[model samples]
Each structure stands twice: as C-alpha cells, then as structure tokens.
Target: MDPSRTLVLNTIIKEKAVFTLFQPIYDLAKRQILGFEALSRGMSGSLLESPDKLFAIASKQERLSELEIICREAAIKQFVSLNLPGKLFLNVSPKALLDPSHPKGETRHLTEVYGLDPKRVVIEVTEQDKVDDANLLLTTITHYRELGFQIAIDDLGAGYSGLRKWSELCPDYVKVDRYFIDHCDQSVVKREFLKSIIELAKATSTQVIAEGIERMEELKLIEQLGIVNAQGFLLAKPTRKPPTELALLKSLHSEVRSSVNQFEQSMAIGWLAKEANAIHECTQCIDAHRLFEQDRKLTSLAVVNDAREPVGLLHRDQLTEVFAAPYGHALFDKKSVIKLMDKQPLVVDEQQELDTVSKQITDHEFDIRRHIIITRDGRYLGLAPLRDILKHITEEKIRHAQHANPLTMLPGNVAINEAIEQRLRSHHDFSLAYIDLNHFKQFNDLYGYASGDSVIKLLAEVTVDVCAQSSSFVGHIGGDDFMVVFDNNDAEVLCHEIITQFELKSKAFFTPEHVSAGGYWATNREGQKQFVPLLTLSIGLVRPDLQHCINSHQVAALATDAKKEAKRYRNSYLFVCNRRKPTVSTVRLENAG
Candidate 1:
C-alpha cells in the first residue's frame, strides 16, 4: 500500500481529515430538484484531495472498513452546517456494512442533529468490488432499512455480478455506473443493459437512478427509457461555493417548459390523429435471445394496424413465467407473432386518455407490462411501449402554450410554417388555396359584432365542410380569411364548392331587414349607411408546378392574386392553377400578339 493512502486512512480514523463536495440527483418524473449527494475527501498537508483515490487504495489494503466509518462521520459533520431541501446521499461500501460491527450511531446522530427525517438520509452502497457473503450483506441492509434509512445499490452496471447483486440486495435505489453511462451516449449495448437493470430494479420495487449524466443527449435517452430519476454533472456539481442562486435557476428553465408544452401539443395531435385512424401501426415480436442480439429490453412487442394506427402492446414481464414455459420455445420459431396466441392482449384505444395508458405502464408499480396497442373495432393497429409515449409526452409538454394557434387549433404561424416548409421539400403535387370572406365587417357592424363572430364561425364551418375531402386541410388565418390545401385533382372543385356554400351561408348571418334593404348596413367606423353586397369567396390554388421550389412566403404572396380575382366580381370563384393548358383561342390570340 502507498504511504500516502496509509496516512489518510489513519488520520480519517482519528477524525482529522475534512473535505466536502456535493453532486445533485434529479427527480426525473417531476423534472425538479430532488437532493444533493454529499461526498467527502481526506485533507492532507493542508491540501485538499479527492477521497476517491485514497478510498480505492485503502479498500485494496484491507483498511477499507476503517476509512469508510471516518468518511461517513466527516460527511455528517459538514452536512449539519448547511440547510437544504432534499435528501443527503452518502456513499458506503458493501464490505464495510457486511462487517456487522461498523458504527452506525454517527449516521443516526446526523438525522437527530439536523432535525431531518431518517428516511431522508439515503445510504448509497457502491458495489465497487464483489461481495463474498451475499446473505450477510442483505441482513445488514435490512437493519438500516428498518431504521427508516433508504438503501441504494450504486455502480450497478459496472460489476460482473450486477444482476446477482440486484436480486439479492433488493435495494431502494440502483444507479447505473459511470462505465455504462460514459458510453450511454453512443453504445446500444450499454443502453440496453442499463434498461434491463432499470426494469429489474422496478420489478422488485426498487427505484433506479441513472448516474454519470455528462451530456443532454444522454439525459434525453435515459429519460425516454423510463428512467425518471438521475444524478450527474449535467444537473449540479458540489463545490465550496456558498448556497448558490439555486432559486434563480428556475428562470433559465423557461426554454424547457416551452419545449415540454410544444411536445404535449404535438403528442396531443398525434393521439388525436391515431384515434381518427390517420396514422399507421406496426408490431414487434423479438424474443429474449433477440433481446441480447438487438441490445434492447422492451417488455412487449408493438403492433401497428392497417389504418397506420398503433393497436396492441406486448409486455416482456408478462412473458416472464410464460416465456420459460414448456412451449415457450415455439415463440422463437413461430414467426407469426406472439399476439396470435395471446388470449387477451393488453391494449388501449387511440381516442382514450393518454393518462389511462400511462396508468397502464410507465407506472411505478411494475405490473406485467408489454405493448400499448392503439386499437379500435377490435383490430390491431400499432404498438409503442409505455416508455416511448411518456418520454414523448413529458418533454413535449414543456412548450405547449407557446406558438399555438387560438383559432382553428392547427398550430399558429410556427407549426404552419414548418408544415409548409416540409411540403415544399417533399415536392408532392399539392394545391394552396387562399380563401377570403367578403362583406364581413359590414355584417359584423350591423349584427353588433357578436353575431358577426357567428358569421365567421359559420364561414369557418362551411370552409371545413367543403374541403373535408380526405387529403384536404383547412386553416383559419385570423379574421374573415382562411386557407385550404388539397391534391391538384380536387383543388378547383373544392374552391368552387366552398365559394357556393360560403356565399349562400353568408346570407343567413344578415337580418331580414338588411336583406330587404339590399345589403346596406351602418358601421361604427363610418356611421353613414354603407351598401354591402352578399358575401363571396375567392380562392387562389397553386400546385408544385406553379413554383417548383416556392417557399411559404412566396406561396402566401402568390395565393393572394387568385383570392383578389375571386373577390373581384360581386360573387365569383377563381382557381390560380399552374397546370391549366392554354385554350386554342388564347393560343391563337397570343400568336397574333
């Protein structure tokens, strides 16, 4: 053993060395601050050094048990000096705990001294090395648990016997070690293994914390896997710095909220679309051996339906007893899918509440879970596990209120712009129609504006009804004007129909007195009686050929011409078409010109 390691442990035993540090563990579900992990370093030559290096050397030299007791005491002393809101996570060694003679009085004193609840003090048992006596370690852990101190299994994914340790220890928390977390950003194998650990931890009523989160990408990945609680540098690091402006940290989090809200809205639309059979579905049938091969650990196979809808869910845990059954081997070669044999598949309809699905899985209590199929009419559509839906829901909800449209509820300018840009890139044959309502303001003035709003809503209804063709879309661009999109084949016909229905309905908004008076009304803008004719609709329809790579702004501008022409006459319909063949007479006229 190195002379320095010997010196540090000896002084630590005498309570001479002192070094303090903190690492933050987050509440993944609440997306809020949970607590700070209190760490210690031994002091030497009046210089600060990580206790980590010294702790490792002592453990190898048979002095590990002594060093652990002193370090726990020093951490306890420093922790009493400050006041914080969350639990204090303290590190411990499995070997030290197994000794059965180590002093636990100091840890209990910490709870009493700080007036903290014993449950708030989490004792982290890092399996940095394997244990020879598993039963003894479990016995020691149960004692601490009975005292209301939570037990955590640390460095969970690093050790070779991680699975065995998990089964035997059955701790309150399990942290996927840094080794796995380091490559989590890149390695599918590591992520899959971590996911398996999380699933296992959950099965035995243990909460899993994904540690060593160094990047945002990794944070997102783990979050999607249903690992809601985490600890890492990306969260917060320990330092001698005084209690920071920790509360101000919330202001900088606006972006996260906005992002979550937007995600929720998008998820909402997706759920709605799935409910309507506007999305397709697919199923996953990979087995346990396939689990190792693919490096993923999902509980159920996902199945998507013919309507592009997600329908049924298959949970892996449900197969836990069944997969090992006498006939379980057939599932591997069945190829037809396990759902074929499932008497009652776990499923939820698309139109149902997302929470209902969440209550089914991503749920804390590990019920035998599998695919959450999106279904209707007793048929399979698509499958997505509970985790995917939750990650998509929580993160997407951060920015729901921002950039959303108040009217048609499609998406205001932001989403509309994105859709237009996407359409432009795809270069599919589509028509852009600019729909306008004529004589709207005068009707509002005469009907006291409340009735005018009714007119606007009526026009909106007709526009939606007229363009309700399967592939068609309609949007309200604030006040009397709306927009519609469709395939080139029906673009003109849709516009004409919208115009006819719109004009006829516009008359309903007026009073019989106004009808008798030949469409004249007085308005607040100008008290004089203004003669307004019946409403009309003008449509500007543009296909991809109209402007090969027309941008959204250009589409907006070009669609206006057709609208102006449609509104040019008392009641008219105009189609701004890019593919209309010139008439022979017009061709002859052009030749003469």
Candidate 2:
C-alpha cells in the first residue's frame, strides 16, 4: 500500500466523508423506471475523489470493507430520504462481503435504520476483479438473499469469472457489460451474443439488464433482444437524486422511437434488382440486332446515357418486328439503338421501397409487361423484369394465404405469432389487440353453423375495414378469436373505431325479428331459459413494450388479460392495459332497445 494514499484513506475514513449519486434504471418491458444504481463518489479534493480511485485507495490500504460499509451507510441514508421508486442497487464485491474484519450484520442493520425493506435493496456484486473462491462467494450471496436482499451479478461477461460466477451465484439480475452493448446494432456478432445472454437469463429465470447504453440505436437493440431492463446515459445520467417523474425519460424514449422508425425505413429496397442487365444507348441498331441474333436468350436490354442513367428500353421482339418490316433494317440498321427504344420506360430509384415500386407497376396497368428500370441517385443500376416482380408478388401472396385463416382469409395464429416475434426482435413499437366475439356461440347455436360462419366473416371484414387506413397486421386466432397488431401510436383510437364498425355490422347478422326483439331465446349455462344478445366484440389491446413483454407468449398473455377485461361488458369494448382505460360503446344492436 502507498503511504500517501494510505494516509488519505485513513483521513477520509475517519471523517466519514463520501456521498452517493444514483443512476436510474429503466424497465423496458413495462416502459417505466425500475430503480436506480447507487454510485459512490468521494469528497472533493481528496486522493479518492472518484469511485475507482476511492476503491483502489481503500484496497491498497487494506480498508476495502470499511470503505464499502461507510459508502453503503451514506447511500442508504440518502436513498431513504429520497424515497425513490423501484429497487436500489448497491455496489458490493465478494471480497468486501466476505471480509473477516467487517461487521457481520451492518448491511442488514443499515436497511433497518432507515426503515427500508431488505427486498428493496439489491446487492450488486461487481465483477471488475476475479473472485478467489466461487463457492464462498455464492454462499455469501445466498446468505445475503436469505437476509431479504436481492442478488445481482454486475458487469456480466466483462471479467474472467463472468460465466462461472453467473452459474454459481444464481442472482436474480444479471447486468450485461457495456462492451457488448456498445455498437451492438452495427455488429451482428455482438447482437447474437446479447441474444444468447438474454436467452440464458430467461432460461435461468434471471432478468438481464443491459448497462451503459448511450446511443438510441443501442437502446433499441437491447429492446429488440427482448431485454426488459436497461441503464445508461441515454435514458438519464447519474444525479445526486434520481428522477421520480420520468417525464424527461419519456421524451427521450419518444425521440429514440422516432429514430428507430427511420432506421428501419432506411433500407427500403433491399437487393431488389442488383443483378439486372443493361446495354449502352449509343450501340448501333445493327450491333444490338446482331447480338440479339447471336444470342436467342437475350429478351430485352436497358439503354443507358453517358452518365449511366437508364434512358430507354429495347425489346428483342419489338426490334425484330421493326427490322422484319420492309426497308426497316436497310434504313435503321446503322442508326443508334435509341431510335428503336421505348423512351418512356418505367424508371424507379433503387432506394424506393419494393412495395411502392410494386404499387406503381400495378397502377401503370399497361406497363405491367415492361421491365422496370432501377437507378442509384439517377445513375442506372439494372432492370427488374416484370416476371420477377410478378413472381415475388405471387410468392408473397401465396405465403400470406398459406398462413391465412380458412374462414376469414386473414392471417392465422402462426402468422400472428411470427409477426409479434418479429416486432419484438426489431424493437418496433406496436400494440396487439386480441378480439373475441361475445355471445358468438349462442348466436351460432340459435341460427346454424353457416350463419355463425357468415358472422365471423362479417366481423373479419369489419376489422379489415377499420384497420385498412393504418399500417396493421390483422390475423385470425381461429373461430371467434382474432388479432390486430398496430404500428402507430393511435391504437386506442383504432380500437374504438373497430368496436363502432362491429356494432354497426352486428345488425346485418341477425334476422329482422331477432333485431326487433334485441336478442334470441337460448338456454343459459345454468339450464335456465334466457334471451341472448347479438354478438358483441371484446378487444384487449396491449402495447408490447420492453418492460412487460419479452416474447410472443408474454404479449399473448397481455392480450389475454385485455381480452378478459373487455369481455366483462356485454357491448363492444376496448381495454388497454398500459393506459388502464376502457372504452365501452353502448351502441350495440343488442342494446338498441
């Protein structure tokens, strides 16, 4: 131990001089603040002003346990006064916890002094240094948990003993090291590693918290990995007091969400026509004619200007027809190929989305048979054949139909599950609405299975019409159950619209007499005769944020909860979990009386 640092440590310890700063940790699934990690800083103008230096100096002076206890004492006092929401993560190390010289019950005593429950405290075992004994450390952590403190393995995957410690300690939380999170969005390897860690944590029933996320992209990546908890400067910097209101964090989340949308849209045209073939505009008609003559496989050619911009398209059949005419070859054989080319060829930017290009082609009506020219920044790249586009569209339609529900032709459970998983993986913001038809079975029993099929089909049409204007994925979960996943923020609005549509359409599903009666006679579940109302729609809408959702199953669970809440009413209703707001429209045909 250095004599000068030892003296400084002794002086600071005797004075009990240190303060704590708290950095807020966010729950991505719940989309709220989960807690704060208490970071200790030394008094100003001291040899150990920063945590690193303070801990180093203490270790050098063989007073590591004493310093840790003092910092814990101060942090606990401040944390209790602040009354922060969520867990308080206090830094601890195996060596410090196992220190023979340290007071045994001081940590528990510290919590008791402030009237804080030990469960609210998480003893974060940092992994900056190697542990001498894994078994001893695991025993110590188990003992701490038994004392009611939660266990967290900090700096996971950042040290030599990382995996081993994770296996041995079996902490409730595992904090991913900053190294893996940095630039994770840009590196496939890092993303895969993070995904593995998340999966591992899930398998072990341990939560993974991604730490040191400073970029919105990194934050999005972690969310995409299905990681529920994250802490970093992007969310909030360390403050003497952690933020209780989360207004600033909410605003930043909005900003990052916008960025994520832009990033996803940046690659609109993915590898669409990179392998297209082209020809020079200045080529002689005779030359193109000769090439076409020599190569029977050459069907069409893209004519480019000097700047490599596609100016026209020439088809072998058209050229052959022109040359086959009397005096056509003699007069135009030596002329430029531009004379025989179609000047108004369909041209599209390479950056244009495939769907937009497809729509353009579809709208052209007459040009569906022609090749679409693709360019990069006005420079010709290649031509996309009509056959390829048609094939691509056909394959997409076939795939959609393969996963479609037989009755409504909407996507089925397989597609819905896939879409949810994809959204979770891509970190796209969306809400899932699980729609169930109330009193559907009774209606089917009163009328026939055929009438029930018609009702299901009608509901499907209403759902499609309601979600038509928005970017949504509507699927059928078989029978009376359906799913609609919305990408926009106005899901609550859409939910109400769907309910209105369903209510309006409900009248057409019933007989005139039944409509007048406002219901039909049916046997109740208790073996009593009763009047059953027309089918009503119950929608359980849940936005799949990082906090409350980790996978498709979790999202389905939330949707189930929302659906249960909505089904509580006899009329069409919408129940949003996060908003805790229910919209019940008393406008159902069954309630017309």
Per-residue accuracy of model 2 over 67-118 as CA lDDT, tens digit each: 9999999989999999888889999977788788978778999999998989
- In model 1, the runs with Cα more than 4 Å from the true position are 1-5, 44-48, 60-63, 241-253, 260-593
What C-alpha lDDT, on a 0 to 100 scale, does residue 157 get in candidate 2?
84
The local lDDT score (0 to 100) that residue 145 gets in candidate 2 is: 86
Considering only N, C-alpha and C atoms within 3 Å, which residue pairs clash in candidate 2?
A: 28-546, 28-547, 29-546, 29-547, 29-548, 30-547, 30-548
What is the model-wide C-alpha lDDT for candidate 2?
A: 0.78
lDDT of each: 0.61, 0.78
Flag regions of model 2 displaced more than 4 Å: 1-272, 277-299, 304-311, 316-334, 343-370, 374-381, 512-517, 579-593
- If scored against the real structure, what TM-score would every candidate get? 0.48, 0.46
The lDDT leader among the candidates is 2
Q: Write the per-residue lDDT of candidate 1 for residues 320-403, one digit (tens) a residue.
A: 555567876565434434343332333544434454445546443433333445544334445555556776666644444464
Which candidate has the top score in TM-score? 1
